[model samples]
Target: MLQKTYDSQICSLARALELVGERWSLLIVRDALFAGVTRFNDFQHNLGIATNVLASRLEAFVDAGIMERREVHGSPRQHTYALTAKGRDLAPTLVALTSWGDRWATDGEPPILFHHADCGAAVGVETTCARCGAVGHDGVQVAPGPGMPAEYLADRRPARPPQP
Candidate 1:
């Protein structure tokens, strides 16, 4: 079982989980961002989500700025969900989680295979940057932004006492 931490004290990781921890929330984003689920009907049909639940989740996503609703050709009142930049940035997180799941959760063989369209070679779930060619988990890192607190940094790495 996971140990519980208060949100105020364990602010950073808690903040991340607060955004993504809800059930079916990240999956909804995954479907929209990677699977190309555009319309309300598409999300419901592709995911087999109940109509009311799907609508509520979509609204929550929109409110969180992960996705935006845009008017498609079909109906002026109807809108299609599209991933915003914030949502697109989550690809790496999803990729890492997918890699972990593939490694630990799989039987001897992968039931589902992903192929590289260009090379036609089967690709295991891994994040590779075309520009840098950096591979493996250590290659990925995130720096705290301006919003991060100096106190938090100090707590993490306090200055040592002066030597005699």
Candidate 2:
């Protein structure tokens, strides 16, 4: 379990990890986003996760503004979990991670495919430069951004260029 905090770290990725860093949290979000799972029981069944753990993750997600828990009109104490815009925004991350897993982690061909909903074309993700339109991470560089504390970055730099 991740019991400690990355409070000393001044990075957005660290913050993101704090929110959805757990394997099951990401899996739950993936099912909610891709498989349209909305109910607690559905998530429990699909993921085969313990009720307590699922409940905690769902609560955390709701608190983080990632998902909204809505009461079902006709049922008592029944609700549906819906991904907010912020939660749906994780789709690309899941897709890219899935692609990477298929390529490097799996032994066989991809078992699933992601396609463009509008044109039905196969979809893929990549990092691109806005100015030169350069594709991939090779052209990427890390420097002080507006959010980074100047002193922190003044004497520190990335050990290697980012591959993502």
Candidate 3:
């Protein structure tokens, strides 16, 4: 079983993993984000997920503010799940992950392709230099961001070489 929390970790990625690292969580989000899957029954049918497990995952997503549960129009006792803005923000992450999986994990060709909605062009994710806007995946490194705890930051500081 996957650990439910990364309470001891001070990293953003770890925190994100706490929510969507589960085997089914990202798949749920993907359907909602891409397929406009909002109805509970639709999710169950599409994913072949157990109803109880879907209910639990939806409840957790609602609690986390990643998704909001709303009553379906004209259907009492029935609910549809909608992604909150915070949840929709995960699209790029999903796209990037898909790109990596297509390249590394899957056989043959990519099963799906993403494209821009406003124009007929391919959509992809890339890392870029913040200051110069140069595009590449190299030279990336982690450091303490402003929100990191002081003690954690101090402990994680990269060792410096002696000055000449």
Deviating ranges (above 4 Å) for candidate 1: 1-6, 112-164
**Full ranking by TM-score:** 3, 2, 1
- For candidate 1, the TM-score is 0.66
- Positional deviation of residue 21's Cα in model 1 after best superposition, in angstroms: 1.8
Off by over 4 Å in 2: 154-164
lDDT of 3 by residue, 56-83 (tens): 9999899999999998889879999999
| TM-scores, all models, native as reference | 0.66, 0.90, 0.91
Better of 1 and 3 by TM-score: 3
Q: In TM-score terms, which candidate is top?
A: 3
The Cα RMSD in angstroms, rounded to one decimal, for candidate 1 relative to the true structure is 6.0
How does each model score on lDDT? 0.75, 0.90, 0.90
Residues 25-114, model 1: lDDT tens digits:
777887876778889998888888889988888887788788898997877999999999988988767765766767899877654455
* Clashing pairs for predicted structure model 1, backbone only: none
Candidate 3 lands at a TM-score of 0.91
lDDT tens digits, residue span 1-164, model 2: 67435898888888999889976999999999989999999999999999999999999999999999999999869999999999999999999999999999998999889999999999988887777664766566676679988788767756775365
